[model samples]
Target: MIASYDALSEARKALDTPLFAGLPGDVAVSFEFFPPKSDAMMLQLWDVVQALAPLAPEFVSVTYGAGGTTRDRTHGTVARIISEARLPAAAHLTCVDATKAEVNAVAEAYWEAGVRHIVALRGDMGEPGAPFVPHPEGYQNAADLVAGLKAIAPFDISVAAYPEMHPDSASPEADIDNLKRKLDAGASRAISQFFFEPETFFRFRDRLAAAGIDAPVLPGILPVSNFAQTRKFAAACGAAIPAWMEGLFAGLDTHPAARQLVAATVAAEFCRRLYAGGVRNFHFYTLNRAELSYAICHLLGVRPKAAAAIQEKAA
Candidate 1:
């Protein structure tokens, strides 16, 4: 049949051609950044935004710190991104160590500052390994926070999804149920925690479909530049780092440039696999560095908007 023949042709191209050759650059991407604590860091983050802006991300998000520690800094960073960079910026707001009134006030301030998108979360505690204890008068969880935000304004909201499972989740089913509750309460989409394996996301997406949850869930991609630090993050978030990846980064500690090249190759291949599987949207956790993310995007055929326009016009 024609369908079977087309499938065979695609497989042949995959095996015969260069992995990154002839990609159409049809994917949509967004980036996440953290608030800077120092003046120098602020400059660095601004440079990063400038570098990645030409790709025309769907939105750039600034992260909220643990227990609302960086509230003012987060607001300032997001405001600058919107006013200065002219990018659609989403501010993270968490239900942690703050009353409902307090959280609502922050949301109102964001609305007044021209921010219409928020990433809602039930944030981690200040202390490591300590269980999250909601404030006595605060929203109980992310679901409650999402509903409260909806009541305050018609903001576009995104909540977190765990592909493996949350460390505190009792079971995978409970995690999915929690995600459902958040979506039902009015979140527009869920951005998953960073995962290394493409199959991890595929299985999670299948499970989401089975649960009858049809919300768009963007896969979070963290191009690993520091293997040792990534291991710590993986341990905290319950994401597994494959054994093969470990061997790739082994003995590259002294070779920073080569390490970045390896990192790009590994992450681009992982993304190409996801793209072949029909994923069109990706979210990158930039960690305030643009090179790794930019290179990966380039390999995936995402060029600057102006460049793409020129190509189209020439054609």
Candidate 2:
């Protein structure tokens, strides 16, 4: 499970977290979920929602699949979270393969449903390895999408940021300029793409500050449930997987249970370092699983109301 016997011991030591002085409520968090295409996945998603509901994240977001492929399903999921669960939910809106009229209509529907937030994006084409092209009649990019959403309503908008620079960007500075444009157009905050090193995010954050853009850019944390899958995701998103990570996950392909502990330990340490660096808000890529995320949050000093009862019993 661990790289070596002493490696396990050292990892546990490295994870001696600085217990949060702030209450869980003081540390704001939000979770991102993708809409389920199958009946079984739908049931499983609700289970995850129920499990994390007690954590009281700032808001939960359901991702819109490429080219608005999951349009109806995304709406259904967001509506249920708002109505059935009585949680504030944000729906992802993408400007790909849809006219501006259609996209604005969807935004109106969300407003009608009492959803007040939107994560605007220039989503990819539905096909694998396909390039993204703007619909002739649709918003041109995320910045344009943010402005369009603002025109419809003053929705609290969140847009994506690339800590390592977007794959399409000509340069990192250009990428930051694009991010500033989105925020200036009306996005309230930017959720960064996931990165392994805290330094990567810190550097990006510094660049944003130096650019004179004043907005919160929350760090996105992905608790790696599967290393192989995560590596591929990272590669696609242009995130670097440092050599150290492979050594940690090495030989654990057949050890799912052990992988959970290692994942928790790595993510908890990641959070601890971020928190120590003065980053307060985090957005987790939950991947429709609760156990790993819940564990990492608990280790970062987040506790549900029910955890208090358990603590009382222990006392």
Candidate 3:
């Protein structure tokens, strides 16, 4: 049933009362992590992974940076997740700065290492507003990359979607067309870029349905780790920030603790609203930070558990 964030808040409140038991069960989730940049960052990333492993995400993804940057770091992270953590990882691969053979080799490496999922993307150009010029012998776009990966193995491929249209997209319609192309070329699913207002995603989903695309579109949930930075990135990527969001973050810049509390409340409400709207899956852009995501997952019925057995079995 379609419901609003307010309705969810009221429902959760009621469920939490002494007379009513709160909702229970694991909520399926997935996290997005970027490659670590330094030794300190690597230690922090493992801590975050250890903290969230109990949630039993469908899978976690390691992001590939622009222009094929972080290629080794991403590979190492994915390989470690598969070999050490007993978690399935989806490594991001793009049609940028790599030939078809190079791309295929990466895919083959992942498959050989037992990492069977990939997030295929026709990544951003090195500089904003610059036209994408394909490599001399590389895949032209995400579709070609998806097809190439499929040729290497039966990977669970996921591609990106734009709810408000990618910055370089000629129009929303063209963005949808690109999404359809990726799916048609063999992507198993699509994860949308983060947006604040739920309606933006709902409208995009409705439009896709009307246009006859039936792929599973996972909502990419990015809890505000740093409001100011998020806003700047949002603007650069063409995502709209509702004025309400600004008001919510207002006066909290100097108050980090309160700001984190508010961030958790906002993100929990966002997921509750989407849940009420019939979205059962979420892909979190964790930015390799743990607290807000852990809190949000707890609110959604995700709880900590033992990763011990899985580690032992894998060993």
Candidate 4:
């Protein structure tokens, strides 16, 4: 069996077999994950981090829970990524319930911890029924948060963008204008909320250009690890779930492996279209699992590396 496999491998190589080449050498990707709540989850998160570390992503970010529920956990997770994984980590900081002094303190601590990138957000209130009310002493909104972070340190900051327009926006024009304000206030880039269709992003990028805003906007890609859950989250976040998506996952309720196959196809196609349109930076929402994300990355042409090959190239 081993001899037969070797012969087949040599035959394939001799044919100079064609496989899809991935993105350009200059393209970059980053990942986002939330801190874990239990030992099992913690173990899972670490396993994922280790698996993807070989890719040498631009950064891996750990998210703060809504209303800043997991503030300490987020800090701990990000710190570990820096110290142990030795990966550049972007920490998510929010202004949901904290004052300027409080949030600035977190920024200071991150600086001391060697964390230089921040995904600043005006995080939502914890309870759905509860309206977000900025602390009387806190930054007012995302733009305010970005400016405050800039004032605290020379941290590279990324803010959220809405391609379909934010749900609470007065108008589409207003949403774009708000994005401009965040960039103008010192955000280095905007990571858009996930959108199903690539056109959603192209239109948003074009609008930003027309509006005279030049901040780099990174497309956020969420692999459908759980279609039902993603659908619900999309609805809550105002990301449109196209009718076709519903049909794609129609009958795979109990067949997770099959569902993942469909997911990889969809996300890879999305990335291919975006890349064709001149988008090079991608930010993946990994959800603390590597299988689907890794599969999607593979489909897009990103693969694990060989250290010896890398060293040889350097030489």
Q: Best by lDDT, which number? A: 1
Cα lDDT for residue 178, candidate 4? 90
Show the colliding residue pairs in model 1.
none
Q: Mind giving the per-residue lDDT tens digits that candidate 4 earns over 141-241? A: 99999998888899989999999998778999999989889899999889989998988998988899999988889999998879889987887778999
Cα error of candidate 1 at position 208, Å: 0.4
Residue-pair clashes per prediction, in order, are 0, 0, 0, 0
**lDDT at position 151, candidate 4:** 87
Candidate 1: RMSD to truth: 3.5
lDDT ranking, best first: 1, 2, 3, 4
> TM-scores of all models?
0.94, 0.89, 0.90, 0.89
lDDT of 3 by residue, 1-315 (tens): 335676676556655663213547436788999999999999999999888777777889999987778888999998998776788789999988888888888888888888888999998777766778899999999988888888889998999999999988888899899899999999989999999878888899999999899999999998997899899889778998889999999899999999998998899888876765667788899999988888878777777656774455333
Query: What ranges in model 2 sit over 4 Å off?
Result: 1-25, 306-315
As a TM-score, model 2 comes out at 0.89
Q: Please list the C-alpha lDDT of all candidates, in the order they appear.
A: 0.92, 0.86, 0.85, 0.83
Model 2 weakest lDDT span, ten residues long: 306-315
Per-residue lDDT tens digits for candidate 2, residues 224-289, read: 999999998887788999899889999999999999889988898788778656677989999999
TM-score of 1: 0.94
Off by over 4 Å in 4: 1-26, 305-315
